[model samples]
Target: MIFKNRLVMFLKRQCCFCGAGFLFAAIAFTGVATAQAGSSQPDVRISLDQAEQMALAHNRTLRADLMLISESKANEITAGLRPNPVFDTDAQFIPFFSPSNLNSDYMDNSAQFDAGLSYKFELYGKRKARIQSARAATVVTSSIISNDERQLRYQVATQFINVLYAESKLRFAEQDLATFDKSLSISQKQYQAGSISHGNLLKLQLQRLLFQTDVTSAQVAVVQAKDNLRQLVGFDSVPQNYDVIGKLEAPQPKLGLMDMEADALKSRPDLQAARQLILQSQSQLHLAKADAHPDLGTTVDYTHLAGNNDLSAFATIGIPIFNRNQGNIAKASAQITQAQEQERAAEQLVLTQVRSAYARQQSALQVVDLYESGYLKEAQQSLSISQYAYLRGDTSLLNFLDAERSYRTVELNYRQALATAMLSEQRLEESIGMSVPSGKVH
Candidate 1:
């Protein structure tokens, strides 16, 4: 009975061990499967607006420029302040003896402490002009930053379009390859049955190879486009690639050409920046001209001589005798002329940029329309006919391959047109200093 009892307990323990091992194995298997599934899934998708926001936050270049604007603001603040006062103190010993003719055996020691406060009120309006100029310079720096942001947003939009284009091409290529594989299978059977020539079979096989090459090329393009988008948004790992569902549509811009010019003249950062420089120059000229006037100052002094102290007050005026500021006045006048010329140049340049940008935008719109209405439809028709001819045994494999190629080429061209058109519109708005409503800082 004892031996039987021991045998029963041993069997129970073995069974328990087996159950434990199975449970552990099941848990491990489940974990591995879950991990694989998670890895295979694509990343989260972001819309165009979301992408723009991300770029604004992460783009290193824009952040660097923002820092520069801060620095310029500091400089503007400094320009408004008056110069600090100067303090002087001096002590001299005359070798314990005065000069032979002056002191005549008297020992001399003297100490002087002079503290003076001086301020110029800028009676000629130079300081006010300087303050205005500094403020204008700040505006200019800010405008430059806005222009940069607009351009960056446009770039991100273009890259996003490129990624979508490459993905679309890859899908089409893969679909065509599958179709060619089936066609090649049919040709092989026909050749074996003596219903089709060996030449036709060879052609189909060659076309299959070509289609496979196309698929490979398209996949390479997709990788490259993804890398570019990643770099643009400062993403470390690849984002989940999603289909771009948006179509390019021209929105009726609320402003006319003349309106754009007016807006740009008022708000365009580059032009405003130039205007600020002109103002700064004007202020400098005022300063130079002000230098021609005499500087008036008052002085009060307390002196001790040979144990006697005396207090005196004096009003002084510097005539600028030898340097009567003639050269500076001429230079200041020249500077004013130079600044006026720059202002004119800036106005002309803004007009030219606006006109050119408008023309390009119009051309882009027309090009996109042409591709959509004409080439895209023709390419689709050609692909349909080629597909039908293959099934009917009327089209050679080479001819069908050419038609497929034409179709994909035209489709890619259409995508390119859409991307370019959007970029052109953005550029036109930027050129005209019209800010897009990007849901960020205006």
Candidate 2:
């Protein structure tokens, strides 16, 4: 009976252990399946505005630039802070080795304890100059950060357009492939019916291969464009497929060239930053001049000697005979000249950018209009008519294929032109440092 009980207990324990192990395995499998499902979920679709917002929020470089503003503000705070007074204690002329001369009292004749406090005073408005210089530096840093943000916005906008263009190409390639598949199907039927020669059927198959190659290349291009956008938006991984939802058409700007140039000079962050640099240089020059004047230090001391208390005050001043910050003063003045020249150069560069982008924008608009107005419609109709005629045995396969290729090329070119137009407009906005009102598209 005891052996039976022991065997039964062992069997029950083993069963329990096996059940637990199976449960753990099941749980692990469920967890892994859940993870995979989550990972395979579709990507979060985003519009251009959303993408820009995300980039501004998460871009590492922009975040680092923002930190510089804080650092500059901290420097300003440091510059405005008053100098701290120093305290010192000294015990002098103590008769330590001569016991006979040494007095038992703590305040003896041969020993002296002195406590002193000293403070250095800034002269010739040096503190005010230093504070002003620091404030000007902060402005320069802030302007630089603004310029960086403007550039980042431009980058995100351009990349978003590229992704849109790539997606359009992929769609066109897929449609072309479908058309080839239909032709291949018809060719196969004709070949089997002995209505077409083997060589001709082989030629059709080879053409299908060409379209397949194009489809593969388009797919790779789309992936690369998306990857570039992801990096700009600061995404670590994008496992699911996502797409941009926006038209490739350009929004016309209402402002003319002269207005744009005026706005750029007034609002362009780089120009503002350059001007702020000039102000900073001027402030530094003032500070350098102030540094030629010396600081005065005053001290108050209290001493106890042989039970006698004495108080004294002294004043000290620095001599400005040598090293009166001549080098820094000269450098500061030269920096002001450099900053002015840079500001002028920046203005010229802005003008060049605006003119170039405007010209490209006009050219792109013309091309887009030419295609959208008549060329694309004609090519598409030609392809449709040729396809129908070939199906009814009224047209040659070569003529039908040529029409198909023409239509595809025209459509792709139209999309490219639209993308270019939109990108140029974006560049113009970046150059002007502001968004222009949308005008009627021609």
Candidate 3:
């Protein structure tokens, strides 16, 4: 910023000179402005929470699942509706071929006319059972959707951390390249002044290529990771050029392994969904049994023929000798047993996931601790000391090069350790069915 201001003042002074100088100043200022604008931060930057929320709102699959709930509610309405009444009307002895004989007196005296209404009423609480089954299925769907949301959250968080890791690696690569470039520059001057041999200078300059390659690889990794994260965040939810912004290292979780396992059992939606499935199956069995109970049909008729009027009533019921819905009842019973077993399996799965995630996070934490236990600082100090000694002719070039490589390796490893620890935290939270403690641990 200071350089930019100084350059602006210098350009203004030049503008006060010849018109040619003014034109040159204007061009220079335009170039500087373009560079500054290009280097500015991206317009779309999202944190982890923002990405997860956007995914939840805009993910097509999730929206489709929510639509199924509406469908289930509609099914409930259909189940609660009663059967429509059947209407019948007939005319005899004066059909279309003999329409001339169909006058009012003829229709009443000669022709016979009849009208009837019939309805089949549901028996044994069949309608109620149907409604209950629909409702229970809807409840199961809701829990399944909740579990899907939980999985989506974990997926988004994991990808967000991946992007963060890639960005951190890119930054570290650029810094490492710049630091090595400075060493190359010093080697160039030393070779010219005969302070260093030409062969040694060539080796230093050649090694700079490795640092440049690291920067290129890191850039590619960053782009790929961002693309993967964008798929989860929903492409339309964020701009194409969006960048992720968050801490590279996750904070230590406050909860222990046992606590995490207990929390998962209490909160994991998959377990809830599994338990709901059992109720859904039971409701379905009740509906199946209700289907076996045949409904009663009743009809009332009015007739007029030969100047006589008559009224009649009829009732009907199925014998239920065959096709008594035995298959559906048996299937529903089997489903109840399957659902019960699934619920038990879900519980065990939750415990296993919690334990595995907690173990991984703990291991990652220990790795991060090892890096922070002076190894990283010592590597940097060793490099700085060796570089100083080599430039002053107090040490050999091999010693300086080895120290530099050691420092680079250690620094990169430390960054990866931090990223691993943070990713472990994300996994642990996913398994635990809630967010653990976050932010800097120390």
TM-scores, each model vs. reference = 0.72, 0.85, 0.87
Candidate 2 TM-score versus the reference: 0.85
List of clashing residue pairs for candidate 1 = none
Candidate 3 residue-wise lDDT, 1-442, digit = tens: 7976676566555444444543554465456447536757666999889999999998888988899889989999999999999999998888568777768888778888899999999999999998999999888888788888888998888888888888888888879878888888988898899998755775675566567667666766776888888887778998666787886774665576777778898888889889989999999999999999899999999998899999999999999999899999999999999999999999999999988887888888888888888898899999999999999889999999999999989988888888888878778888877886544332
Clashes of each: 0, 0, 0
Q: Which prediction has the highest lDDT against the true structure?
A: 3
Model 1 TM-score, 2 decimals: 0.72
Clashing pairs in 2: none
lDDT of each: 0.67, 0.82, 0.83
Best by TM-score: 3
Q: Could you give the C-alpha RMSD of every candidate to the true structure, in order shown?
A: 15.5, 15.6, 10.0
- Per-residue error at 8 for model 1, in Å? 77
For model 3, the run of ten residues with the poorest summed lDDT = 14-23
Model 1 lDDT-worst window of ten: 104-113
What lDDT score goes with residue 150 in model 2? 90
**Candidate 2 — which residues are off by over 4 angstroms?**
1-41, 192-195, 236-240, 440-442
lDDT score for residue 202 of model 2: 58
